[model samples]
Target: MSNPPELPEFPSPFNFINNVPITLVELRMRNFSGQIREKPRWWEKVHDADIVAKWRSEIIEQDEKVVEQFWGGEKRFDDGNGEKKWPREKITGAQLDYIFDELKDLAQAIDHETGIQRTAIDKVYQSKTLIPADLKTVFLSGVSILESVPPEEQDWHPGANDQVLDLVHPSLHCFRIGRSPVLIPERTSGCPDPLFVLTEEQYLEMREDAEGAIVSQFISTNYQWLPTDFEVSQPGRRLYSNITSILQRFLPLFERVLSDSSDPPPPLAVAANPGGWYEDEESESDLSDDEMDARWRKFHWPVIHDPAPFSPPTQEGRTPLSLNGRKLQVIIKLANIVLTPERPKYPGGSWHVEGMVNEEIVATGIYYYASDNISESKLAFRAAVGDGTDEAGVSWNYEQSDDRGWTVAFGLRQWRSMNQELGSIMATEDKSSLGRGRYSAFSLSTRRGPSSRRATFPAATIVVPRRAGKVPALRALPQEIWDMIMQYALAGTVSLEEAKQDRLALMEERSHFVIEHNREIFEVEFNMCEH
Candidate 1:
């Protein structure tokens, strides 16, 4: 994994497994080889069955322990005064992808499906294909994927020496996510039925996996909160670019950075997110009621002073790309990614991005969509002039319930309005939930036609860190601004000048979270990841 870790979502503790660290990847590649079945009395002559069997179970246990180490949270146990606790995490997308890639190779080399399974975990985690039992045994015995490894690699192959005795199980029981081709870990880690225990040597492998998981978890937990070490690349720079392709379509409403004035407006202010620096510092928090009201005003509409020295948002041909030839620093706190399936009949969709700064809705925006057949773009976006509610006040939004058990504000009314709009688009709604759809949003497809301006749309389809739906790949702003804000947040001190930095850091971390882990609720694997 050459990835320089970016900021993470849910703070440092929750993150993606970028890549198996280079050293470990190479080492494990050697120690985990299975025996070929063609040899006579292969179980006895080629390998020790008893030793293999013992190792097999140990491998599974070790894998589970790794999950526990990084993510386990306390389940309340009865204490005289109150419930006591532990910690937890789930499996991430990167881990799942790694497994899938490895399995693909094993499947090709083995004769029987079970053969591939055995070779993959050889005293590692046990994985059986969901095929029939009678077929399973034959597959296990005949499947020899030794050929799958090139000859040079064969001698170099490593088997989990500690779990060297755990033999491969015959039964397969893997699960898939909907129509997605990827297979995930089974929810239950119950001892594999017909599971054989491990020999002493075989038990060593689990310890290794546990150690690896722990290291990975530690890196994941720390990197997220710590500053990133990334050198700005094309993708990073684009986030700060003046190109506004989608914003331009909405034609000049984007009030980009201001030129001429060296001073940033007072509107810019930074505030620490609760549980950000150190999980809730006090049992009671410190937000004033007036502060909450001010935030409401900002989310509803942009606030400009009566004297208005700085020009307010005006529909000019896309606000100038550069404010004094520089990009403004800001973080887009990406709260959620909703795959909304809206009015199926109309060539339209929208995304409601919401976040608070200084007790104000500094990052509220709706990305609107329409068929840009003339432009040849299927998904162009229309952004509001400011991070506020529409002129009509038709939509409002809020946060869903979370594990912390803390009280938070929600925009159920806004969600209901959004639900109606989407229902009208798709012509479908849960009979029980009525106009309010059963879920927040659903997936949608964008079709581009020849000669059309690549059907552009604002990020209305789902909630993401930045609005990639309408904008091009995000351009990275100068690293100076990002680091400054991150530092301020950690220090538990925020200033107006550091406003943009705060917003940007928050978003950067959120995106990192999404990329590293599955964003969907159903996709998270708590037992396999760090919570």
Candidate 2:
């Protein structure tokens, strides 16, 4: 074979990856001058001093029998000094409130003979928007699509080393444009519109007809007519409907994130000379080298201030995200991790985003529908930050030489890649049972935004296949001729086996691209002296 064509280079570092142009926002570095938005700690929300004081006063005013009845019993404790203390003084405000809330909820559930709400359980750890108990049945039905496939037919996640089984992964058989071997186009010109999205009913019907097949006949045969006359399969019909229901529940949360990300909080005003410990030049001149160094370190390395409280605008205040009448391109994935006596623990997953640039996924929603006998797992998130060299609109009025102080104020470290830890979400498990598994479903939504260079589909008429007996013209054709016609019709598309290999290759290429890109953006050291 002759030498392969050389890959063209682009001006930007994050231009083309795996032959697809990356979105600018995909790896966009954030400035560090703004107030960090973080979820409040459990204590902060529930343990307000004023609220606690009012609760204590109320409890003290009540009679002993009334207090006992309200609290389910006499909640008294002996202090170290041997003084008897009621729960008002002994228990924290948060603890007392949580107890009362739980008692009230339990009483209501018992009276109505209904199951306790998942929100009550989640409140113990202050987790919000969890998959409620009632909705979990629908989510679990979507997860049950995995059972239809045989053990041998199941496809394990490519980079996960057989640890993760992809029951309905979009990466396996994603919609493709252009020719074989290179499904993704190099440029957006002449590419089909990537905006056509499947309706919930259409998506479900397609999956239902596929019968657990990885490749859909409708899409393969009508590759040129995708997003119009094509069908894609994943998780069966029931699973698709259930996933739609589950996604509806998470729409508000997704909308909130989208809203917040688009319009971030403003930065807090930095004081001219914060901490008030910097010495004048005359005082510094009098100090010895060791004393000066100590002073610099103290001024530079005072404890990094806590992030500001995250309080986004309420739904009524903000403009509503209208998704009605709009078709959505959704990628569904159901995953389960089983733990037995032999394998008691799971090591968790590597740091990675949802999809490659080709997928153009904007928002990802994960629902932990089932977790039994598993340890408390959490999904941590981090983002790339700017190197602070060219932070516009920020001017530190402190001493010019205090480079370290600026780094500390920005919550960044010198001589390190600027990657900020953006907290994690708890995927709490039930430790009541043993040797069970955890099941979760992921729904990733992709849209064709202005910045997106993803490919779309061309409008075309669908050629519906008819039964052999129903089509007299087809029935009259010889077996060999009919086979030739079928082959010619599918000549534009690759086989299921070829598609699987291509998916693996694409995943591997994307993985390497992400690793190298992350290294370039986040692993390089920052030197203050050079600046």
How does each model score on TM-score?
0.17, 0.52
lDDT of 2 by residue, 1-531 (tens): 543232121112222111111111111111110001112222232245674455446443442343253233322211112111112122233433433343333334221122112222111111233445665665456555654568888776666544455555555554444342221122223534312233334433533333322212112211221111113256456655655675565444444433433342333212223234234444667889998876654443323222223233234544434344434444555555544444344566555544433333345555545555444455555544453232211222334334444333343334555444433444533111100012232211222222111000000111111111110122344575546545543555667687687677666665675576556543444343422
Clashing pairs in 2: 193-456, 194-456
For model 1, the local distance difference test gives 0.24
State the local distance difference test value for candidate 2.
0.37
Model 2's number of clashes is: 2
Best by TM-score: 2
| Root-mean-square deviation (CA) per prediction | 31.5, 17.8
The worst-scoring run of ten residues by lDDT in candidate 1 lies at 428-437
Alpha carbon deviation, residue 194, candidate 1 (Å): 66
Positional deviation of 1 in candidate 2, in angstroms?
58
